[model samples]
Target: MSHLHRAIAFTATLLAAGLLQAGQVRVAVAANMAIPMQRIAVEFERATGHELIPALGSTGRFYSQLRGGAPFEVLLAADDEIPARLEREGLAVPGSRFTYAVGRLVLWSLDPHGVDPQGNVLKQLPRGRLAIADPRLSPYGAAAIKTLGGLGVLAAWQPAFLQGESVSQAFQFVASGNASYGFLALSQVMRDGRIPRGSGWIVPSQYHPPLNQDVVLLNGGRSSAAALAFLDYLKSEPARATLRGFGYEVVKH
Candidate 1:
C-alpha cells in the first residue's frame, strides 16, 4: 500500500474513535424534571462530550412505553418505585437504580397575594377551582393528595378539582389562570431559593411521603458507554449543585 493511502486510513480511524467516545445516550425523564434535567443535559455534553436526548412526560406513561419497547437507554423517574419495578421486571439493569433527588412539593398561584408560606391559605381561600396532577399517575400528585388529606382539606377540595395528566400540566393549569391554585414540584416554581413571579407555600415534608426521584440504567443501555457516564455525571458536584439550585435535594452516594 502507498504511504498516502496508509496515512488517510490512520486519520479515519482516529475520527471513528472520537465519535465512539462521544456517543449519544437516550434518556426518559419525568415532566417535572424538565428544567433541571435540561440544564444537566447541557452541562453533561459540555463536560463529557456524551450527548443526552431526553423524552419528557409522565413517568407512568413512560413506564408503559418502556414495557412496550421504547428505545430509551436511561430513565429519570419522578419516583423510586417505577424504576424499582422496571428492575424487577428485568427491563432495567439490576442494581443500576439509585435516588438522585428527593423532590419537594409546593402549592402555587400566579396571584400576588394568593398564597401564604404558612399554608393557611388553603383553608381560608374558599373552595375555588383548583388543579392537581392525577394521583394515580404522578408521585407529586399523590404527594399533593396526601398533603391535602393531612391538612384535612381533601374532602372539601375534592369538588373543585381539575386533574392534570402530569405535574407540569398541573402547574400550567394554575399558571394560565385556569385554576386558582395548583400543587407542583418545588423545582417548577423555584430557582435559587425564590419563587419567580408567583406566590407559593412549600409544603412541610411531614405532610406527605418523600418524593424520592430515582434514575436507572436500562437493559437497552447495557452496552452504551454514554449511558453509564451520564449516570456518573449526575453524581458529580456540578450536577448536584444544579439540582439544588432548582430546588431538589440531592441524594448523596
Candidate 2:
C-alpha cells in the first residue's frame, strides 16, 4: 500500500477506537434505587460498551448536590417533581425526563412468617421495634407515614418506631434485627416475588400515593454521549423487564 493510504487507514482506525471507547456515564440516583440500578448498569455496559458511575443517596440530598454544582450527568430521583423542578431551574435538559419505575412499600420483618398482611400487624407485635425512614427527608419515609395513616395505625404505632436516614437504611435496620419490622420498598424484600430471609407484606398501591421514580438528563450531561445512551437504555424493554423482575412496576407513560 502507498504510505499516504496507510496513514489515512490508521487514522480512520483510531477514530473508530475512540468512538467505541466513549462509554462512561456518571449518574446520581436515589438510595432506594441502588440494587436495581446496579443491575441495570451492568446490563447497559454489556450492551453499549459503557461504564456507569452511580452516586446513590436520598433524593433530597442528591438535589442539594446538583443544586450546589455537583458533577453528575444524570439524576435518577424517587419522584418526578424534583426532576421537573430541576428542569424548570435549567439544571436538567428540558424534555429529557421520564418515569422509570413505580416503587412499592412493604412492611418487612426479619423472622420468617413474621408479618401478617391481613391488617393491623402493628397491634400484634410482641414488644419488638419498628423502623421507618424519616418522613421529612425521605420520600419513601413520607409514603410510609401516609400508608400508616391510611391504615389507621399511625398514632397507635408511633412509640415503636425507629428512624433511618433513608429507606435502604431502614431496610438494613430490619434486616439486622435492630428493628423487628420496618417499612421498606417491595423491591428490597422480594427476590422474584418471595421474600429473602424475612417475611413482608406488599402494601397495596391504593394505600399511598404512587411512588413514581423519575430519570432526567442533567444540562451538564447533555454533552455526554454515554450519559444520553444510558438514559435511553433505561427505557428499553430488557431494562424494563429487569426492573419488573425486582418487583418494581414499570410505567408505560
The per-prediction tally of clashing pairs is: 0, 0
Best candidate per TM-score, number? 1
List model 1 lDDT by residue over 87-129, tens digit each: 9999998777889999999999899788888989888646568
TM-scores for candidates 1 onward, in order:
0.91, 0.89
RMSD of each: 7.5, 7.3
Q: What C-alpha lDDT does candidate 1 achieve relative to the native structure? A: 0.87
Worst 10 residues of 2 by lDDT: 3-12
- In candidate 1, how many Å is residue 40 off? 0.8
The TM-score of predicted model 2 comes to 0.89
Q: Candidate 2 — which residues are off by over 4 angstroms?
A: 1-20
Model 1: per-residue Cα lDDT at residue 67: 99
